[model samples]
Target: MRYTSEDVGLLIKTTQYRHHRGLDASLAATGISLVQWSALREIERNPGASMHRLAELSFNSDQAFGTLTARLLRVGLIERFQGPGRVTHHRLTPRGTELLREGRKRVMKVLVLSFASLDEKERDMLGTLLAKLLT
Candidate 1:
């Protein structure tokens, strides 16, 4: 194997950061940050999911997710209701659903542009390798 000064791990991290930044920038006009959109998407996926579960799915701490939920509530993007006992569940409001739908379009464009350098086979291979790493 050929040795190089740059670490592959760092390269992967930087690539991910650039991709996230690109997506976030593309979503600026949607009135929600990537983090908020991500939480909304998670809520849509797991309707009636508790805040803790949503936080985990969205890669946020409970407190952070609570703050996010509060903001979304203020903006009327999401609503919360008591489940059983102290547990609370969330759902996307109609506005939230609309924003999420629009955000998907913007994110898709950014992702496509980001991977434009990679051909179909290479993109498939890259996805497989990345999924393997996660596993």
Candidate 2:
């Protein structure tokens, strides 16, 4: 079996698409999109994370972050509060935390099943390679 440039491109695109699709489907029951889910997860892990920080962490453009924040705000999942010197900070509501915890379990189950074919070493290598791609 040979891997071509097109194959690599497809691999990357499809992997991302499928991951997002799976998460979106699982999160649908929780009334969140994949991006919203991502935002919640990051905020949970990094309490008081700012919109700019979330944008950077998610690799989203300013417009994208703004859009997502609007949606998240509309859903009552997060709230913006004044931080030091009046800077804005994002905090997860109780509902957001519970949703994230439950959605994370579902997402993890999907990911574990998806990666079941890969050996532990392959999974580690994939993680390292993907990190390199990001960097």
Candidate number of the best lDDT: 1
Model 1 has a clash total of 0
lDDT at 103, model 2: 88
For candidate 1, the TM-score is 0.91
Between which residue pairs do clashes occur in model 2? none
Model 1 lDDT, residue 68, Cα = 95
lDDT of 1 by residue, 46-106 (tens): 9877778999999899999999999999999998888888888888899999999999999
RMSD (Å) per prediction = 1.9, 1.8
Candidate 1: stretches off by over 4 Å:
1-6
Native-to-model Cα distance after best TM-score fit, residue 85 in candidate 2, in Å: 1.4
Model 1 weakest lDDT span, ten residues long: 2-11
